[model samples]
Target: MKQAQIICPVCEIKISTLELPQGKNAHCPRCDTQLYRGSHKPLRDNLFLALTGLLFLIPCLFFPFVTIRLFNINFSANLVSGSYALMKESSVILGFIVLFCSVLTPLIVFGTVITAHWGLTRQHFTIFKYSLLIFQRLKHWMMLDVFLLGIAIAFFKLSEYATITPKMGLACIFLTQIVTIFLLSRLSVSRYWQRWQSSEQFQFDDVQTHCHHCHLSQPESQSCVRCGFIIHKRKPNSIQKTWAFLITAAILILPANLLYISIFYSNGKRYEDTIFSGVISFVKSGMPEIAFIIFVASIAVPIAKIIGLIYILIGIQFKHVTDYTRRMKIYLFVKWIGKWSILDLYVIAITIALVDRDQILDFLPGPAAIAFAGVVILTMLAAESLDPRLIWDDSASNTPQKESLHEK
Candidate 1:
């Protein structure tokens, strides 16, 4: 069976998304933008994978995750312990962020995906329609992978001062993270959307109105039947909203780097670490790899995201815009890498969770931690708010090439 899509999501060019070689993907012949991936697996496999990931998350939440023994005082912590500790210390917002990003968010992503695939298998199109939309938007919020990486970083940082042992919950979390990633790879919106599309016969005005959620074309001024999103040629006020978020993040990022990021009281003496000092310490201790990662995520990513966004915005608005492909690539990269900046917060949360606070030593999130977290969140929001399609729209230098399937 040959399934087809009406228009290219990136360039908004009217094209056919059919007849790709197995194991290869269909890229837009004009701009080299990938349209959809070819999948040999059935929708049932996706359903099972989503269900398996959800099953693993159960043990990951409650079972003992790590045990740390410092000075003969043994303390155990689970996945939720970080949130509890933060809440007890009066960081209500940070507490909720950790708990929701680690647990509730993943649950929503996995549960919605399971429902969507299940609905597809049972021919209950209505169920999958809305469920799929929910999964698409919230899928990136599943920071379970980043949280697990935090555990590894915490283990390395604490191993010198304490005896750290991985427990059953760690294994469950690893499996859940891997399974969730695989499930996402297979759950292609365009592939599923093609199945729901009744006919390949193109309708007038359909090619002009493209739905970002479903990646399908429909008439103007109407709701997308598959996803129920109100059709807009481009996201409404994308540039203005994105600029507001970017400006706020840019302003906060300076203080976030300059101020102490983490603070602890050891034997009644205060020790504070700034972002640069922490990176320098890591390098001084011969863990340059970890140092580099922190520097990139904490420092480089935010700056790059802001610059990339600014360049794209300026490129689109200029009278003579060139290198549309380059602009689109930048946009995609910025959007994809924005979430990794939260890794720093995860490290702090898990590190604090591992050490039980006492008279001898107490850990607290420094004022800078909140500022840095704001930058991460605001950059993510900024990326999501901008419509990449705007880079190609209304550009005189570039025109849509003839319709063809260029396999990649």
Candidate 2:
């Protein structure tokens, strides 16, 4: 008996009739809509990315991303030094921000990424489960973009006072992050799970619908106008978690500001540089550029990150969006802004390197910097951890689809 074939309503492509698997995908050859379905994605690519990312993570941690040279005096700064300097400067809020992004978050993220990849590659079920959990938890904490921005800001600021030199460690970190990104791009758990199910034809009874460009949804018959892609009714916890983290960050911001951030000791006088003071100091110093950087990194970025997270979360929380395009724009903006908090660390690093040795002009860090750094890193992690599809959930129903014209 010849199998029945269904024609795609929009693309008019002929699809051979087969047992349509739940959570699987089939595409229209012409327009690439979900005409029939199979699995999420292939596991091999995701596994490869996780493994490669892990391998590169080690050097990313151990190496110093930047170096400073001043008046024939040279010193190396690491995560510890950066944090400590902020504490000495009495801007411990800023100090903490530096510490988390540069040190703690990176360490946790690298470890988690590696474990997740290794578990999948070896097919160690127990390890894979644990890795999935770890990936979920630490995914948001890794802040590569922030680290890079810190490096850039530090380079520019330090150059004005001392000759800033990029170190081998910095080079290694840059390369490793590039490799890690490539790896992350390849790894997707949903795809792997789907592939496994396909091989076994497992009857999981999970009715999952996905759209490559549009967010995943319940089998709908419309293409999204924003991305011109089909939509999904459901999406990953990316949006919810993003919103939760953003709220948490917003709540913490009050304490971060209220508490001591960092203390700056210069010329036998001690002054605390709060979020506001940091901005004032730079503006007063006639370094408008540096002041602006500080304002964005320490002030503007954190708040923006929170707001963006909230927008994404809310949209996803109540799927079927009208602002799909706008939400996407906000997510990208949040992603870019999250790194600005690294400014505090670079400034502190420069302060430590420049003002420490001179007997008449000594500088020290404080406590608040540490906490602030934590806020920045954690918030960034929250952003990275979120999935991007929540923005499209609102408009899934009426959105145009390639398959709506013909029904099975």
Candidate 3:
């Protein structure tokens, strides 16, 4: 029997699927776009990690994440308190966004993954399929990694004026991030889907066209049969759309840095600070690690992302296809870290919520917070708009390969 095949979503080239060796990935021979990766570990192992991460989340919610003492006054915050504080302070939308991304989404993702794994083990096909679908949707919203970076920024900012201490919940959050990353790396959903299909003796039709969004196989059509999203060989004007978002983000990064992020008031003194000021404060306070993180996430990452997107867009526009693999890796890295740029805004939200008193000590949100959030969101959209398969399309012809490796 002929092996199954999938068309590259970005390049629209039909390629045979390969059963990747353990810890290996099959890239398109022409464009070097990663088609699929093999998981070195079993699905059960990923299940365990997901469960472990879920357990760690308990401490992250209840226990103190950080403590700050200023002028003999001490205040501690947990994950829940920040959201509640923001809501209480009338920033309802911001509050919900923080809570959903930091707490609710992570819980949902792990829960869904756990359910899917259980269904897989028990051969509950319906439960497994639906659970996996939900998991795929929730995974993008789980921002614990971004939340942890926010915590680091909060610590650095607080340390500059108060006696700051990392609490047990903070440690737990870090560990949860580690386990989540590990679980995601080991659990290849595509591979598991293929396995389930094999066990069920389900076969996809030999169709040249497939939906990029839903992965639905169908005859050549203009829209996805399942999703109703307009189907295209590649994203419509992918390069132009990416460039627009990237340029917009690049333009916003300046005011995001130059304008004040937050203003602090204490004992009749006022201090307004930008992102760089916070980094400098941390460094001067002997917390070089915190400074480095803030600098990278706030400064380096955003600039690097804009520049990286520009490089990729330029390469695609001009048909300069050298180092396709390296550029693809860069694109992946940019996509992965794009959300972390929101850490500074998150820190401000949490801090504003915590330190809002009349006289003693208080912080006010600044104009830059909105600008910074815009930068993060725009870059994320840019990453989503730019298809990685386009990187390969520049060098390779549109012909579909017939004799590609088969998925096992």
Whose TM-score is greatest here? Answer: 1
lDDT of 3 by residue, 31-126 (tens): 455566655566777778888998999888889878777677777888888778767764665577678878888888888888887887788877
**lDDT, candidates in the order shown:** 0.80, 0.57, 0.75
Could you arrange the candidates by TM-score from highest to lowest?
A: 1, 3, 2
| Model 1 misplacement above 4 A | 1-5, 121-126, 197-206, 225-227, 397-401
- Top-scoring candidate (lDDT): 1
Please, what's the RMSD in Å of model 3?
A: 4.1
Cα lDDT of model 1 by residue, 1-408, tens digit:
255446677677777555667788777776677676766677678778888988999887788789988878888888898888888874878788888889898888888877887777788877878888888888878898888878877787777778988899999999999998898877887667667664354445334566777776666557876567788777899999999999999999998999998887777778899988989988998899889988998899999999999888888778336788888889889988888888888888887787656657767788898899899999889989998788887666335434768876
Candidate 3: worst-modelled 10 consecutive residues by lDDT: 194-203
Q: What's the TM-score of each model vs. the native?
A: 0.93, 0.60, 0.80
* Global Cα lDDT for candidate 2: 0.57
| Alpha carbon lDDT at 327, candidate 1 | 85
Model 1 Cα displacement at 394 (Å)? 3.6
Clashes of 2: 71
Candidate 3 versus the native: TM-score?
0.80
Clashing residue pairs for model 3: 17-405
